[model samples]
Target: MFSDKSCVNATLISGTKETCSFFIFEAAIHWAEEGHRVIYIAPKALQSPPLTHHDRSNPSTEAFKLMRFMYLPNYETLVEQLVDLHSFASLPNVLLVDDLDNYIEDPGVKDKREVHIARLCAILLDTMNACAVILKQNVHICVSISSECEKIYQLYFDKLWKIEEEDDGNIVKVKQVAACNAANKTYEYRKYGSENIILKQILYSQN
Candidate 1:
C-alpha cells in the first residue's frame, strides 16, 4: 500500500488484458474494504465493476465510485476527467487510472510532439498533486500504464513497478524500477486462482 502524497505507477508489461484487469479490480476492493472511497477511471471497454465484500448497507462503510469514459469524438483526456471529479477530494480516496498510456500518444512532428507530451504530463501531474493536497493526506493515486509508455509516466511517479512475464513463461516478475535511495529486487508472481494474485520478493543469499 502507498502512503499519502505518493504517486505510484505500475506498468503492466507482457501481461494480458485479463491479468491487468484482475489486478486493478483486486486493488480497488482491497482499498475500498479498508474504508477508503475508491474512484476508478478507465476506458469503457476495460472497465469492470469492483466486487466489494464489505457490507455496503452499513452507511459507516465507505463506497466505491466508477467513472467509465468512452473514446468517442468527445472523449476527454485523463486530466479533463479528474478536474470534473475534484469535489471528491474531501474523502480519503484511491484514484485509479486503468490505461493512462491510452492518451500519451498523439501524432505530431519532432518539436510539436515534445511540446504536446509536456502538456499532457503537466495536466496529469497538476490534477493528481492537487487532489493529494486537498485530501489532506492518505489519497492514493494509482496509474496503470503500458510498458511502452512507462518512460513518459516515470517522470511523474514517486515509485514505479515494472511487471513482465519471466523467460520460463511460468510466472511473471515485478521489479521496482525506481525508489528513494533503496535497492529493489525482483518479486515473483504467484497465482492462487483467477482472482487471487500475489507478488513475492525473491531473496538471494549472500554467499
Candidate 2:
C-alpha cells in the first residue's frame, strides 16, 4: 500500500520468539509486489541462505524457488563472507535480518563479535526507512540487542522502539516500547495486541 519504508516510524511485535514462516515472508512479498526493494538475510547460523544467486526473479513465490531456498551457503562460508555491513545497509529499502541473535550472533566468540555485529545493528537503526525488522529467536540476546539500541537511540535516533513479549501464556501480545516526551522524561513503554499494532499512535509517553 505504501512504498515509503521510511514510514515504518516504529515497530510492534510479540514478546517471545516466533517462527517467521511463509505468512511473514508473504507479508514481505506484498511489500515487494508494490515495488518496494528488499534485502533479506538470515542469522549467521540460519543466515545460510538457500542460495544468493538465482535465475528466478521471485523465488519465494515459486515452488522450485522454495527448494532453492534450501540450498544456501553454510555457516562456515557465511562467517567468512558476511563481514561488510555496508554491503547490507546499502541494499534495497526493506531488509530482513533473521535470527537477530545470529546476525550479530557468534556461537563461540567474544564481545569482538558483538562489537562488529552491534555496529551493523546500529547502522540499520540509523538508516532512514519505512521498515527495518531484525528477527531474534533468543529473548536474552534480543534483550541484549534492545538494551544496546535503547541507549544508542538516546544519543542518535530521533525515536526508538523495543518490540518484545509481554505474556507467554493465556494469549500472546506484541510489546511496544518507545521514546516519549513527558514530565518524567523516562523512555515510555507499552504493550499491545497484534491487531492493535496497525500504524497508529503506537508510540506514546508513559509519563
Candidate 3:
C-alpha cells in the first residue's frame, strides 16, 4: 500500500484508553510491512489481561497462545522480554520496546541505568526513519517523553494527542491535536488515521 510516498514522517499518539492501548500495535503491524522498525515504549503500568483462558492440558502459558496466534512467542519473563531489544536491533523491520524509561531515573540501580536506556532509545531512533511507536501510561510520563523526544520526532508525529480523566473520573478521551516541525511541514489532525508505512511479514502462513 506504501509504494509511492516520500513525505514527512508523522507519529500519531491515540488519546483514548481503548485506542491508545490497541492502536499502537495496529500501527506497528502496518508500518513493519513497509520496513519500519516499531520500537514500542511499553507503558509503565500495563493493564492486566482479563481472566479467561482455555483449560488446555499443557501448561497455562500466554507465550504458547501467542505462538499459536500470528505473533511469535517473544520471551518467557520480564528479563527475557528485555532481550527483545537485541532482536529488534538485529531485525530488518519492526521492533517492539517494552519501556524506554525502564531505568532512566530509577533509584537503587546500577550506574549505567540512565545511559543504557537513553542509548537504547537513541539507537532505535537513529536506526530507522520510517516511524516508532511509543506507548506510555499516564499523561505526565507521556508528556515527559514527548518533550524529551521533541528534537527527534520533530518531523515524525504530525499529530500528538492526550488522554486524561474527565470531570466524571472516567478515562476515555481522544483528540487530534495539530503539530508543526523544524522542516516547516504541516499535517492534518486526525483522530484515527494510518499512513502508508508497512512492516515485514512471515514467509509462510501458520495454516
Candidate 4:
C-alpha cells in the first residue's frame, strides 16, 4: 500500500481483530510474489486451511515458499526473534507481525504493562535501524494491531494505516492515518470477482 521510497522503519496497520490477520496475510503474499522474501510472525498457530480458503489469489508453491512463517507464542519469544534477526543467512525484504496487541497486553504483565510495551517498541525501532545502518538492508516492517492499540504503538511507526469494512463488507476502506513524508490519503476498494474475493482499488483521495 506504500511506495518503495516510503520509510519502512515501522508501519502500523490498524483494523478490527477479525480483519487484521487476513489482510496481513494478503499483504505477505503480495510482497512475496513481487520478489520480496517475507517473514510472517504471529503468537497463535497459523492454520494451513486458510491458505487454501483465502478468497484472493492463492499463492503458488514457489511464491508460498518465499514466505517463512514463525509461531512465537509470547512477547518474550517475539523479542528474541527480533533481536536475533541479523543472524539470519539472508535478511527478509518484509517482516509482518500479526496480533501485536496480544503481545503487548498480556495478562501476565499486570504490573508495568506499559513499560513492557515501550521496551518492545524500542527494540523494534532498534532492529530496523540496525538493519539499515549496520547491515545495509532495507527491511520493511509492518505490524497488524487492533485499532484500540494504535495510539500506544503509532509513535514507534513512521506510517500508520487504518482499515475498515463498509457497504455490507463489499467495500474496504484504507486510510493513511499518519505518515512521516506522505500526504494523508484514503483508498477505497470493491470486491470485483464473482466470489467477491479480489479487492480492486476504485477510489483514492487525499484527506
Candidate 5:
C-alpha cells in the first residue's frame, strides 16, 4: 500500500463488536507475499479459532512474526519491540496491531479510559516519528480499532477504513471513510470460493 513514502499509517474500524480476523489475516498474507516482513501484535494470542491459518513453520521463512501480550505492556516495552522490528535497515516491514486499546494500558494504576487512550496514542505517535519516520525505512502501520476508539486514533493515521458485515451476515462492506492521499473510496468483500475472500471496488452514488 505504501510506495513513495518511507512510512505509512492506516487504521481500520470494525462496524460491529465482532472481530475482523479474516480480513486482518488476508491482509497480512498479502503483504508477506509481496516480500514485506509482517510483525503482528495482539492483546491475546489466538483466543478465537481463525477461519484459516497461514503456514509459517519453516525455519527459513521470515515473512511473518507474531507477538502476544499476557499482561498490559508499558510504553517503554512497546516502543522497544517496535523499534527492534523496524530496525531492519534494508527490509520492508509492516506492523499490524490488533485491538491496541485492549493491551496498552497501565494495569496497576486505575486511570480513566480517556487517559489510557491518550497515553497509548502518544506512544504510537512517538514510535512513528522515532522508528519509522526517522529511519526512512519502508514501513506500514495498520491498526484495527473499535468505533469508540476510532475518533481518537483517526487523527494519527493517514488512511482510515471501516468494515462491516451486513445482509444477515452474508455481505461485507469495506469503506474508506477518511484518507489524506486520495478521494473517498468503498469496496465490497465477497467470497471467491469455499474459503477465499476478495475485495472489489464499488462506486457509491452521492445521491
Candidate 6:
C-alpha cells in the first residue's frame, strides 16, 4: 500500500471529505490489522469509530489497540506535533492526517496565506525526513486534502491519488494521478453489504 523508502514517503489523497475520510480509516485499519502501529491525526474527532471487515462475533481487539488518535484542532498544534514527532519513544509505521486544508486555511492566518501554507508544508516534509533519518526507517505520511488545496500541497508528495464516488453511492473509484517512483493506475471498489467495501477490479494502468 506504501513505499518502503528510508525517507519521507508522502502521499496526497484528494477527494470529497466523505470519500477521503473513508479511505483514510480503511487504510489505517489495514495497517493496524497487519500488526503495524498507526497514528491518525486530524483537526477534529471522527464522527464514528472505524468499521472493518472483521466478523462481529470475533472482533480484533489487538488491531484497535495498535491504533492511536490525536486531535490537533489548530494549525499551531499540528505543527508542534510534527516538530516533536522524533522525541517520542516509539513511532508508528504509518501516519494519517485528515483534512489538512482546514489547518492551512485557518481563519487566523488572514495574510500571506500562500507563504504560511508553504512553510507548513516544509515543516511537515522536513520533520518526516528528519525522523526517518534519526530512526533509520521509512516514515510513511498520508495526507488527505481538499481538491482546492491540492495544487499547493501536491508538489511535496511523492504520489497523488484521486478518489470519486459515483452518483449511485455504491461505487468508488481511486486513481493514481501521479507517482514519482511507481506506475499510475486506477481501481474501482464497490460497497459490499452495509459497511464493507471490496475492490471490484483494476481499471487501468499507465507508466
Considering every candidate listed, which one attains the maximal TM-score? 6
TM agreement with the true structure for every prediction:
0.65, 0.44, 0.36, 0.79, 0.68, 0.83
How big is the positional error of residue 167 in model 4, measured in Å on the Cα after superposition?
3.5
| lDDT minimum window of 10 residues, candidate 4 | 48-57
Task: Please give the distance, in angstroms, between residue 2's alpha carbon in candidate 3 and its true position after superposition.
Answer: 14
Lowest lDDT block of 10, candidate 2: 135-144
By lDDT, who's the top model here?
6
Which parts of model 3 have CA positions greater than 4 angstroms off? Answer: 1-92, 96-99, 108-120, 129-159, 167-171, 180-207
Residue 139 shift from truth in candidate 2, angstroms: 27
Clashes of 3: 17
Angstrom error of the Cα, residue 124, model 1: value is 2.5
Write the residue-wise lDDT of candidate 3 on 114-193 in tens digits. Answer: 45444534444343322222211101112113213333333433445443334442223433344333222222222212
Worst 10 residues of 6 by lDDT: 50-59
Tens digit per residue, CA lDDT, model 6, 92-119: 7678899888888888776587787788
What's the CA error at residue 59 for candidate 5, in Å? 14
lDDT of 3 at 99: 27
Candidate 4 per-residue lDDT, tens place, 40-159, comes to 999877664232223556788888888999999887788889999867876776888898888887766665866777788778766655555544557778888884653567567767
lDDT of 5: 0.56
Q: Rate residue 192 of model 6 by lDDT.
A: 69
Clashes of each: 0, 16, 17, 0, 0, 0
1-207, model 5: which lDDT tens digit per residue?
323333555555565434465556556666776766666666556564344423333322444443222222454555666556445554335667766655545475476766666666656555554555555664666777654544666556666678766766556687777534556667786644344445545856331
Model 1: CA > 4 A from native: 1-17, 45-77, 88-92, 106-114, 167-169, 179-181, 192-207
The list of candidate 5 runs beyond 4 A from truth reads 1-6, 16-19, 47-49, 52-92, 104-109, 147-150, 179-182, 191-196, 204-207
Candidate 6 or 1, higher lDDT:
6
